[model samples]
Target: MKCKILPPKVLYHPVLPYKQLTSDNTHKLLFGLCRTCMNKISFKCKHIDDPTLNKHDKIHEIKRCKECKNIKNEKCIHSNEERVIVGTWSTIEIDKAIEKGYKLQKIYELEHFEKTSTDIFKLYVDTFMKYKQEASGCKCDPKYCKPDCENDKECKTKIQYIIDNAAYNLDIDKVKHNSGLRFIAKICLNNLWGHFGMRDNFTQKEYCFTLEHITKIVFNEKYKDISTMILDENIVLTEYKEKEEYSKPNPSVNVYIALFTTAHARLKLYELLDILQERVLYMDTDSCIYNDDGSEACKK
Candidate 1:
């Protein structure tokens, strides 16, 4: 008998669709799938028709298939509507200030406080000090002293002269003074009331006169007369009117008065209306159209 020799077995590699399987009894097989293309692949082992093939010979493991790696390269876009939102709330410091008896000043303070770092108490202190200095007429400086006064007639004479001048100038009798303290007090009170939305009923003339009086008292000086304060003839009242025709009525007459009054007049008008509304509704429960039950109530 002649000895038989087996020829080298040919290896076959097959590619299939994803999830496909291959079965062949003639060859040992190994399987793998590409992550990129998700394609199934099989490798045939050279040991064909061998019943005792090694278990490790049929195993193939991939850490990450090529398909998954490609997914990592693509960028993900998110909708703008789904983006995070940021918001802010008003600070409560002003509310606290109002609760602490600053209701009057709080109005203007709230209006202008954010624009400036200074507080209401600081403004009060400064105004008080300024008015005090103006009232006292003192230079706010210490008086100069003389040394070796016994032998110097010139020094003595100078000292006497200074004393006379100081006495005459500082005396209430010789110095013409206005009511500064009262004026400042009035200004502070008016400003506070105005901030609190109080209404003024004074006519334009009366209002201007009151303001001018307060100003004169505070600064101890006279301002221009109200007549002079009015617009001069050089400023044309109405250009649209013909030379032969009477001037058209100026709608800005009252507007100019209100402006000169520094908007306090208009604010006062609103405040008066508010007061009237409150007074008219006082003790009349049925006057409120919207009731607590969310139904319209009979007007009283």
Candidate 2:
């Protein structure tokens, strides 16, 4: 979703909506979904600790609990605690939650969300697809070849073919069972977002052998959270992170891409869960377990 947020008045967090699913024993069929949704929502208040604040302003205020000193109580929403949801939720789901006394409060209308294409994973997906296609070319029959097919170049085995064409961490047994291809496909499908969203300011390490080097690292104005370990009388190990201003931007890191990818995926899973409803038995990031009573819900 595209919308402007007034800073200080609005805070954002990256979270998947599927994580909010209940862990009770009411779930049923095991099914998988793949897709996404993008949204930005603002909610009004539900439970407030203070009784004197104006109603409209109180809606935006989060209350810390007296007993737990937290804004939320997972086991139950106490009379004194209050919070506003910070992620996506469907209109139907919100209504049901409110009907069941869930702390949904009031959800504002979303502006708009739509799909567009990009070349983010084009190279990786295309390369693997080509490798998979070429690997499937060998007929595995000597009769099909004119001279008994002994040359690895002419009739390459799947392992030799992939190893020569792709730099994959292949499992030999799984390759025999054709699962290696699936594993590689899964990595291509999922790991791209993680790579694109990797944190840029990760802790960096330096090994120092002299007091000057140690002092130089410890006193660097561009770094923070300096930690040191004396390896010996002459050796020291130091770890620290570059200050935000000094940190370099990662060329591949685009948090918006990562967020939208997972958001769409959660919406896809939610669609299936809506169909399964009371039959859903278990839940995972991209899949679910539920009951199948010959109703052919899976056909949907």
Candidate 3:
């Protein structure tokens, strides 16, 4: 079914102290002893000012100290890198583990599995809990909910009203599966990045190309001689361009190549190998060497 892609939501930074707290302004730090760990936690002057300090003392109450909150944020960001490195296990792992039930959890629990920082662990657990709750049709407790909770009847009603309006305005099913949705999202996201002039942590287009061009490149017979082109260990051409560029090229036919460094290329090669499996019968380290026949090589 044909689907119309919706415009992507403008990417915005979460409200942060770096943005909210202006430079050159002295913020009073309020110290508090943690009730549980007895560890000292400092809150920012704006949110947690010392009560003993005079009202006109120009003290700002901080919500949370940089030590507690900022470190947590940093660790959470680092956890993403760790997750990527620890490749996801297939369902087969879980299925096999199920045979032993809680014994598997016990064994793995005792083994010194690489531990993430507490803050990162909490963030992952919270996210998993949220998704589990959502999938199971369970409501999160207000006490445990994130700060952006709409608990009051009016706020809740407003949220539902907005959701209902959005549901009425857009085709939800089509939005979920639309092929052009990612392209539209990329354009919108890049536009937002340009508009806001945010350099770091914001979305950027690494590669952009039409589906027709991608399909042609993937299925093209002209690249069959690519195997002979790879000559040495250090040099492997991951890309190839036709000797003759197309005449009367379609506007959407241009290819924006994303070249990977040597290290990344090795990792990508392995990843592609895993995905292709048995279909990829033979893959020489430097080239795509097929065992079928030398006749196909001469044809190109």
Best by TM-score: 2
lDDT of 2 by residue, 1-300 (tens): 221111111112112232232223233221111111111011223456688878665644643323323322223322222223344544443443344344433445553448656765678766665545433334454345433343445554744665466555433333332345646766675677788778899999999999999999999999999999999998999999999999999998977677666656666677787676677788777889878876767667
Worst ten in a row by lDDT for model 3 = 11-20
| TM-score of every candidate relative to the true structure | 0.15, 0.50, 0.15
Sorted on lDDT, best first, the list reads: 2, 3, 1
Question: TM-score of model 2 relative to the true fold?
Answer: 0.50
Query: Largest lDDT belongs to which candidate?
Result: 2
Query: Tens-digit lDDT track for model 1 on 1-300?
Result: 011111111112111112323333233222112222212223233333335546544332121334434443433232222211111111232222223322221121111134433354466645554453334332221243222332345544544454365522233222212356636755774464344443322212322234555444334322222232423433312111122232343332433222224333333343333334423332221232222332222222
Misplaced by over 4 Å in model 3 are 1-155, 163-238, 243-300
Give the 10-residue window scoring lowest on summed lDDT in candidate 2: 32-41
lDDT of each: 0.31, 0.53, 0.32
Rank by TM-score, descending?
2, 3, 1
Q: Quantify how close model 2 is to the true structure by its C-alpha RMSD in Å.
A: 14.4
| RMSD (Å) per prediction | 41.7, 14.4, 31.8
Q: Candidate 1 regions off by >4 Å?
A: 1-129, 136-189, 192-196, 199-300
